[model samples]
Target: MKIVDKIGFDEILLQLAEEASELSQAALKLRRARMGINPTPITCEKANLHLLEEIADVTLCFGILNLSDTEFDYIEHTAKKKYRRWKKRLGIDKE
Candidate 1:
C-alpha cells in the first residue's frame, strides 16, 4: 500500500526523529561525564548501551528497516509510485 494509504509518513518520521534526538542528547551527556578527570568508563559504557537499546526499541516501533523483505519491497514500490505521480503533477521530471 501507498504511504498515504497507510499511516501518516510525516508523523511517523517526526516521532522517530524526536526519539533519535532524545537518544543523542543522552549519549552526549554520558560522553561528557566520561571525559571527567575521574571518569567512570564502565558506568558510561552501561549508559551508552542502554541508550542503544532505547534507539533499537524506537526503530522497531517506527518500522524503520525492521519490516520483512517482502513488506519493505511493497512499501518501496508504493512510495516510488506516489512520488512519481506527485512529481508529475508538480511539473517535475525524473532527470
Candidate 2:
C-alpha cells in the first residue's frame, strides 16, 4: 500500500503520540510534586508506564507506516512478547 493510502492511519498515530506526550508531561508534574522527604513511588511508576506506552505508540506508528501484513504480524508478535517480558522484569502486572 502507498503512503498516501495510509494518511488516515498516520493522522491517528500522530494523535496518539500527541496524547502520550501530554500524559508524560502530566506524569512529570506529578513526579516533581512529591520530591524530597515524601516521594510518591506510585506516581513515579505511573510516569514510567506513560513513557512505556508512548514508546509503544511510536513503535506501532512506525510499524503501520512501513510494514506489510506478514511483516507487521511478526513485528506485533515480537512487540507483545517483549512487552510481556518487560512487564515481568519490572514486576508490573495489570490490576
| Predicted model with the maximum lDDT | 1
**Which candidate tops TM-score?**
1
For residue 75, give model 1's deviation from the true position in Å. 15
> Would you give me the overall lDDT of model 1?
0.72
Provide the overall lDDT of each model, using Cα atoms, as 2-decimal numbers: 0.72, 0.68
lDDT of 2 by residue, 1-95 (tens): 65437577668667667866776776665666457355555666676776677677665657556658898789789999999988988889552
lDDT of 1 by residue, 1-95 (tens): 65434666676677678788878877776776678765655577777776787688576655653468898789789999999999988889664
Each candidate structure's TM-score, on Cα atoms with residue i matched to residue i, is: 0.44, 0.38
* TM-score of model 1 (CA atoms): 0.44
Worst 10 residues of 1 by lDDT: 57-66
